[model samples]
Target: MRSPCCDNRGNNNKGAWSKEEDQKLIDYIRAHGRVCWRSLPKAAGLLRCGKSCRLRWINYLRPDVKRGRFEEDEEDLIIKLHALLGNRWSLIAGRLPGRTDNEVKNYWNSHLRKKLASMGIDPDNHRVIHNARLHRSHSSSNATRSSIDKSTNGLQNNSENGFRDDDDLNLDLTISLPSSQRTGSDHLQNTASRTLLLFP
Candidate 1:
């Protein structure tokens, strides 16, 4: 009767590692520097599979690991990198110091994707907001031109009735104001205002 490779007897009586098991694995890896996973459990006196020990050490016990909450800048970088790299979590994690691919993947799935979606930005394509902005600008320009044309047509029609009034000019001014002004929050206020006036 042959036993399974992962059986308790084959694993040297180890299953899920305890805190003590984790400490033993860490200490062994630190002293020995990952010579071989096949030989690690025997060398470290751990009752666990070499593969399990390696995973625990690399994923959880590595000294360079950053275990706390992801910072704001880290979150932003993750979003940008994810946009560029998609689910190539290892590549994204490589750009982020002390963060693991598993950690980054979890954070993206749990937080960053939702945040981008909430901002009306596509997590998969970062250019969604830019495209929307350009579309809105084009539509706004068309609307303003349409309004001006309508006002001009009204004025031409009314020339037969009477002279143009101050109220008519005021209406034109109001209709034209937004076309010459920016539409966004204070963070973009100066840039938008400058662009609107300059471009107009």
Candidate 2:
């Protein structure tokens, strides 16, 4: 079918594509390769627009695109990569050849996220959901700390903060500060401020 994006440049179809349209796209791509999306539709005698053709090819018609349900290994790798990569689905998809970025993103939102939630892990942060409680703790503590600061004129809590509960949350973090930020009385004051995440 032609896509609305085509400006009906002569009854261009839109919405769901037909089997014939799919075949046309596949045959065209198979014959001439999938480059020059902006010119591909006309070259292939399709009413569809270039953008639609590109999406159809990348998400469905491509010879290497995987179909059916995601495998267990893919699910596991998705979780692990998600923990490290967050919403960079393109990067994640690159690791799994034959899997498209949209497919991974959809599977994550529709299925794997729920699976993680069922197991008490946050798919977003890839950490225990309860650790979100730390945010509340941090806020209240900051409030208290603020009040204490007003009263004591510079009092500090340098003992141990709950943010160090990485083992409980199943998170590992490293920190690096620019020399400009790290070299100050902060070193003498024994305060480490806001360099708690470093990933290479």
The TM-score leader among the candidates is: 2
Cα lDDT tens digits, model 2, 26-123, are: 99888987579878888988888888888898889877788998876677666666665568787667667788889999999998777666554566
Q: In candidate 2, which residue pairs get closer than 3 Å at backbone N, Cα or C atoms, i.e. clash?
A: 2-13, 2-14, 3-13
Candidate 1 lDDT, 1-200, residue by residue in tens: 77543436654745577888888888887787878887788888888777777767766888888998987667766664554346878756766777788889999889876665545455554433544323223443344333433433444345544534321221211111222232443112332211211112
Which runs in model 1 stand beyond 4 Å of their true positions? 1-16, 127-200
The RMSD (Cα, Å) of candidate 1 is 20.2
Give the winner by lDDT. 2
Model 2: lDDT of residue 168: 31
TM-score of model 1 relative to the true fold?
Answer: 0.55
What local distance difference test score does each model get? 0.58, 0.63
